[model samples]
Target chain A: MELLGRETRERFGLRSRSQAGILIFSLVSTMMLLSSLYAAEASVFKKAREAAIETASPILKFFAGPIGWIEDRLGAISDYFRVLEQNEALREENAALRQWEEEARSLRGVIAALEELEAYTPPPAAKPINAFVIGEANDAYVHSMIVNAGANEGVSRGFAAVDERGMVGRIVDVSPNAARILLLNDVQSRIPVFVEGSFVEGLLVGRSTSQPTIAITKLANGDKIQPGQRVITSGAGGVLPRGLTVGAVAAVDKKEATVELAADYARSRMVRIINYKFPDVEATPLGAPGAAAAAAEISAAETAPATAADAANLPAAPPAAPAPVDEGD
Target chain B: MSTRADVLMRLAGAATPALLGFLGVILLASPLRLFGGEVPTPVFPLIIVYFWSLYSPGHLPAASVFAMGLTHDLLSGGPIGLWPTVYLVTQQIAISQQAYFLGRDLGVVSIGFAVAALVVSLIVWFVMSLMTATVLPLGGIFWQMLATVACFPLFALAFGRLHRRVVIEV
Candidate 1:
């Protein structure tokens, strides 16, 4: 009877310990979840997350190697099967591009002559950093990818990424060796764009789908945006450069139109991160104006009293600058 | 063998689940781009947590589950704490139903996992939508749940073998 009593006590003790383990761990998990949910952008949690990704980047790259190899092999097989059709299409495209090339050469000469006449100073060339995609997160709520390029490789937040076809996304987070790209299809993505010919400005908003739609569209001269019209970055806010091909309008609904992106998210292994720095308007004057004159102009503009009439005469303030691009944690 | 060696071996055995769980997270996050399509990734860590919690709760503790889920969140660049909470809930459910899972055949075990996957999917979708303040698309989550359910048998087979080889002593 004494032995049976001891066994019973030990059994109860073990059960209680197990229960305590569950309770304590549950509390810890809850605390962690709450902290992560409400943490600030520069909070320790975000920093730690970036550090962890940087440490594990090499491991991810190593694992992607075999998968990329398989993808290449499959692509080669597909290419082999479609070679004849692709060859015919390329032949036609080459013939058309040859004609465009001659026209482009003539236009380049004219533009150079005009620039010389006006003493036009071109903007600095954009530097592109080539990087391989090592990881991807395409779930129901988040759409991002990790490229094997970071601050060390001249990749900074807000730098645009593009594949051979067209725009892919913009870098949002950068660690030492890896950067997170908020893909174009993420719900939080918004880019300033305009129709190719009509120049109707609008915000391209992501819907977490393959195709994003244009919102807050401003039609110029009653020009209606039609399907198949090309879309390009407007460079309104000077974040992205002008004339970067975004996509083609797939469908127009009442006020908005869906765009079929040019960059094939799938099968894009390499991307180019374009490092574009907006020219400082305050620092570089258009002509050879003295510093005092430029300063005088700035102070006059700031000190000039604005009347309701002056405000009305001013051009409508550029459509509410699109919200700063940042993905929620 | 020395006492220290014996203890070390036991600790290592105990850590098998967490180690495997982390590796599964890394593998899932890698850009496999399988079949040249935007395939939804299966929550492999959840499967690992569910399997171990059911088969040997003492070996796979809640803390390890939390660590694995946290790693997944950081690596996948998703909302923080999202997967960790989902995984902790999954572990609790699996532990609560452990008795019912014992002595069950593979088919029954898979069905239980299917149910668990559904619950996990719903929690992720619902919580993410709330966090983002938008009703996220449902099609991706549905396909992800299907993928997770379909891959359960394979993971179970692997984990079962590992359990027999390494975790049994712990």
Candidate 2:
């Protein structure tokens, strides 16, 4: 190694110098390319990238078909061995579900009477469009997928995408017949979520991993959180529907908690794109925007001793938007 | 080893490494997500690029290396030039040190490949960190490197047979 380095230095000739020059040139060119791509014009490049993908999608599908078929066949073969155990588990789950169904029916009757007295009307149920995952983002850093159903199938941007297991992601970009879903674990993803038992609100910012940590923005300093807690979408942002299963807490620390996602992204082949629209916050009763702004101001005004009191003066927990009613398949 | 079909055989021999590199990228991109997200992606191309560049630089040219990297980048959804840069640099380094590996046995080559795989992984991690402007987690990258290193022998065996049957005959 030392000998080679010394030889490279001492025996510098036209050939060696040319090779070194080529290496330097290539390195500089690559760096320049990186800088340009890093600061790429989002609008122009996004359209171009989408167009390029659209054009190439057919070829990709043609190649991917055989591989997908083989994978499914292999999965089927493996499932054959576990069929008995799965059947038993399913039977047990079915019995438990029947009991829950009976309980829900009784609760529904009581809730109906209460709603009649209060004159309450729940939001309409969201329509879900089923789509097969055709391809995933080729880049390792970008956790995303391209589903077959797109604008043609009413799969549009802001629609939350979920699989049978749980929340997968939401539609980011849609073409005529295909849509791109930015998965939950993508770095660019941030969704409002809460602990199921405690109902503690937090921002679930994706760390590009299954074990994404939740930043408890609503919590005061030194507040406690624990492992094994279930996380669910809070629907604070309105883009995502409420009560969607996110994941269970994998680890908890003094400040943040990591969640192990419920959806097995690696193995998920199909997903449902939910057609949902955020309610008009501007026209709401308490003006959610105004209250949110006030909360923000109180949060920012930390130096003042009366900060907590000032926060208290904000709207006393304005009524939450009607939760989206789940419609079972 | 020359015969009436020498030219055709040689051309096919020259193309095998790039074809294998392409297949490696395909295997990574296909539904068979190697190790199922425990590792982001195995450096399959890195193994082939290093093996061929060291053993038979003439058969695997720099142009083919760039093409393989570009193809992978297109399929990978990463920064377009990242893998190309990595592959080209790895190939150059391997070619430069080909003298050291010429008469070495499989064991020595495996050790050399392990070291090369480590270096390649570091380069990829550094470039990706710069691209994302964040210090990314190294665990996945390390796992990917180990996976790539482990799979190198299988590729070596297959490529060795192809080379012996084709190159030696041609």
Candidate 3:
């Protein structure tokens, strides 16, 4: 290797130099192309990347369908073995949860039904389409995952993505057949949350680390945000719905509190797509500014710390769009 | 013993499966759906690349590695050049170590994979840091390396044989 390096140095002829120059030029041009690819808005490039996937997806599905079939055949052999263990575990856990369910039902019976129920009504989610994963880890550093479902499956941005166990992330970019999930572990991810203990509201931030943290701004530092206390979405920014299960306050580091998601973020599979779109512009096609109004408002609520001043704010949801009805109606 | 068809056959085997495996690995590693979110890291690609680099440089061209990396970049949504760059760097290392690798046994190769996984994981983490502020625990990356390195023998042997059989024929 050293000898070749030395010999190449010695072969500094005009032709050799010309070849070197051409190589250098081509190299620079490729770098420029890649840089431009990287420089585009994450959403634009994400869409383009999704477009690429859309074109390539069919080819992949062609292979995946067969592989999935084979895997199922093999998995069936193994499935029988875990059945006994699964049954015992579920029985024991069910007994404990049923106790809580009874206690909770008694409390609910006492509360006034209508107004309280309205506050507790869970938001509707988008129609989820399921797909088996056909790729490797998407990003380890960021808490994100890419699933096989995409726009063609009615998946769109701002939809909630959760595994059978718990919340994985929200959909950020979508192609025809695949979508990228921005996990609660992503540093850029922030959703409004309320402390179940005191209803103290704050935001859940996805820090690239495995354990995501909740930043409670409205509650003064040293407010009774104790370890083992629970946290949930407060529905402040209309992005995530009210009262979604986030996680418990695992530990408090100084003024900031870190949360450990109930579901294992590191290990997840068979995620459910909760087909909910934020109350912004409609979940329209690409370039449709349908959700613009809601998007801007949600973005503002996410970025600006909620304070006493914004506490009294209740921008009524736009009158429900008239349901698409039959001509007879 | 090597023939002209060697290149054609290796490409034939790895071409579809290597990229196919890459896509498969991403979905398997996805933390979206099921229990035990064990994500397969760059190990599959790394193993395929590393094994081919040592055994038959002819079958695995640098350009193919570049394309695989770009595909990974798009799917994972990391900075575009990061994985491709890591693939190239590792490919170069594999080629350079081929002489020493010729006589090494599986244990040594596993250790070599560890070293390579460490280097690739570190470089990927660093380049990815420049993209955004997602900072996953090093433990996650390290555990990924352990799993990938542990499984090296399977892919190495499988890919190596396919290289021999297909390349020998084509």
Candidate 4:
């Protein structure tokens, strides 16, 4: 009788423990789901996440170097085996590109003539800062990368990053020595884009896959968007510059089109940060403020003849261009 | 003096999961691009979490598992709390089957890990779809699951050697 009572009590205890574990699991999962839902809107979580990324960046970069080198060596060995085929493919592509280049040159001449006729002042040149990729978000659900460039190197949030091929992403977070770029395929990424031939404006949303979701959100009624149409940034929201090549349409449905990104992010070792800022007419002068002012002063003086006193008054030719930033390669 | 040394050894042993898990996170985030295609990188930390939970559950508490997942989320640029939830659930399952796995049969453990990987991968896919408001393509997730299961045996062998050689009762 005593043994039976003891066994029954133990079984009851075990069942209760299991029940408790299940309850705790459910509670924690609920909280996590709720938090994830609000993560995009939650500033506190964003700051905390950025701080954590900053803390982990250095250690990650240190360990990634040897592994990357090994991978690169293996890739090279594999490439050697396919050299003939690859060479043939490249030759064919080069021939096609040459033909396109001639057409592009003619189009450029026409566009230039039109711009001159309209007295249009082109936007300032985009400053390029090259940075090495240090880390990547390896999960399937979120595509992003960490680069060595940061605020200290003038890489700010929303600045577009591109490789030799084309668009990579935009800087989403930056510390002093590192920044995170939200790749074009990340679920959170959204960019304004337009079809090349038709000029149909669309919203390109990342699907966390190779192809992005391109919805023709704004377009003229009855305008048909065809597959194989080129896509470029529309610069509607002012986050990215206008006319930056994004990708080409791979497929189209009634609701959305799919874009195959031009940049081969998996193979890119280095990317350039495009330091582009939309021209703020009220805030900015016609040209560089100091240089323009100095040029005007020189021209005004030259109208009569410069005296030594006038020369002293002329602002020093824009202080010798600050030595180029030392990007830790 | 002897007791102090024993405590130090235990403390070092206690830190094993955290350190190894952090290394997995680093490897997961490394920009090596080892594979040529668009397949997702193998989840290295998941292996660590599973191994430690089975062999040293008391040492690597659930809290540590949660923390590692949280760290992965912050670094991997996903929605915060997603990985933590995944890790916690996986850890719970591993812990429940801890006794069944104590025999250290590599086949059983590998099979168990494969199931865990499938469950975790499915959950991740579901949660991501919910977040993105569209049924995401499962091809990448499927490949990631396969890669993770494929890598489990190697990680288990390495970790087993470490456990027997370095972390044993000396």
Q: What is the interface RMSD of each candidate, in Å?
A: 2.1, 3.5, 5.7, 2.4
Off by over 4 Å in 4: A1-32, A100-120, A281-329, B1-9
What ranges in model 1 sit over 4 Å off?
A1-42, A74-103, A284-329, B1-8
- Per-residue lDDT for A216-262 in model 1, tens only? 55886778888999999888888988888899999999889999999
**Model 2 C-alpha lDDT per residue in residues B1-170, reported as the tens digit of each score:** 46747777777776888888877765655445533444555667888888888877667666777777766655544556677787777777776777688778877887888887778678777776776577877766677678777877887888788778876566
Q: Which stretches of candidate 2 lie over 4 Å from their true place?
A: A1-25, A36-45, A73-96, A107-118, A137-142, A173-176, A220-223, A280-329, B1-16, B34-41, B130-134, B164-170
Q: Candidate 4, residues B7-71: lDDT per residue as tens digits?
A: 88877766877888878888888885765644568888889888877776655666677778778
Estimate TM-scores for all models. Answer: 0.82, 0.74, 0.70, 0.82
Q: After superposition, how far is residue B151 of candidate 1 from its true place, in Å?
A: 1.0
lDDT of 2 by residue, A113-223 (tens): 979875455776889999877777534455777777878899878888888888998887777777778788776668889898775899887775567789888874554
Worst 10 residues of 3 chain B by lDDT: B28-37
Clashes of 3: 29
Model 3 agreement with the true structure over B1-170: per-residue lDDT tens digits: 47757666556665654554465434433332222244434356777777776676656666666677666666665555666667666766776676588778977877777788889889766655545545545665676677778788877777667766665455
Q: List fnat, each candidate.
A: 0.55, 0.15, 0.20, 0.61
Deviating ranges (above 4 Å) for candidate 3: A1-40, A59-89, A103-139, A163-165, A207-209, A264-272, A275-329, B1-35, B38-42, B133-136
Candidate 3 structure lDDT: 0.64
Model 2 chain B: ten consecutive residues of lowest lDDT: B29-38
For model 4, how big is the iRMS in angstroms? 2.4
Per residue, candidate 1 scores C-alpha lDDT tens digits across B1-170 of 68989888888888889898998888778876655665677767878988988888788777777788778888777767778778887887787777689889988999998888888888887866766678877777888788888889999998899898887764
Q: What is the DockQ of each candidate?
A: 0.50, 0.28, 0.26, 0.44
